[model samples]
Target: MNRKKEILEKLAFIKSHKELVSFGVKEQEVSHNPCLSEAEIAAFERKHSITLPDDYRFFISEIGNGGFGPGHGLLPLNKAIVDFKLRDKPNISLNKEFPYQDDWNEEWIASFDWDEEYPDTEIVDAYISTAHIAGCLQISHFGHGCTFLLVVNGNEKGHIWFDGRADYSGLIPKMKDGHRISFIEWYVTFLDMEIENINKSLTNSTTD
Candidate 1:
């Protein structure tokens, strides 16, 4: 599929909608930010020593670099490291391959004992070192402490994982119809769901 074209077309549809606010789109949220130039993207890749997943790279380069996307919008590449505190923690490697292949068992997760005396930073650091994807970059904040992780290396390269930090310390593959989806697919699915909600709202309003 021509994901780039599909993304652009859906964005245009969202932009042209008259009831954007009703659809949960904030003013100037779509197509308002400057996209990254090829040079800038290249520089980022060179500095990180890894190639970004193609769909994500294309979105930032061709669509918009930030300010409009799934969740709290795609984070700017420059701010990603700091926003995610990748530098503050030495163990979080942006080049290490993502390590997990499956979701952590719920019962096993529940077994984690929270030490009241344990420093929050230490707890977070421990999790980061053990579970965080080494070369994965956060692409979006899905509200309630959830974020989308794009793997740039390891077996999961090119796949997007849903980070459910608010509820649990686990990464779940973003799946659709039992199949894993890419960044574009995830975003498009989100948009489509929003559109469906908008239509429902409109229909209900008319009937009332």
Candidate 2:
């Protein structure tokens, strides 16, 4: 079977259990939001002047629009757009180039004085822009201001990025085995982990 079909099976498996291992169960409960249609996906892409990554596009259209994903579940695509707008007062357009190709502010995350680091007005503007993480979808919120981003434009298009600006940690690519993590890889990894957790729970019950 194809990846989407495989994912569908896994989602079904996750739903079979009353007790789920993943977070966001209170809201999503292994149930998916309605799947988006191909036309709708196209419309969204046109509206934003972006091409949604294939895995993510397939996911929303073939699997689920949103629900039961990594980090407090996926936001429905439209909701993601709204979330992006609400959080970014500048209303950065999705078509804009994503500001970063790699991690920003990843080093020297230690005690510091802003006066020394951002000594100039230009640098201050850049510092503020770094936190925006423009040109992506705000797909998930892990609470405390942390969110997962799906890059729709720029060099990192099709990659998932983690924004930890909540703690001033900065934006970074989500990586596995030194390669940028794609949407399916990230989501399926979570599904497999949740399945394993359920299996372990079942085995323990049997042993008891």
Best by lDDT: 2
| Candidate with maximal TM-score | 2
TM-score of each: 0.79, 0.83
- Which residue ranges in model 2 land beyond 4 Å of their true spot? 23-27, 83-92, 106-109, 113-131
Model 2 TM-score, 2 decimals: 0.83
Q: Write the per-residue lDDT of candidate 1 for residues 1-208, one digit (tens) a residue.
A: 5777876776777666636434345634666368899999999888878898898888788777777677777777776544353345343356677886677434544666666443367665555453565677777777766678877778888888887755566778888899878877777887776566667767888899
lDDT of 1: 0.70
Quote model 1's TM-score: 0.79
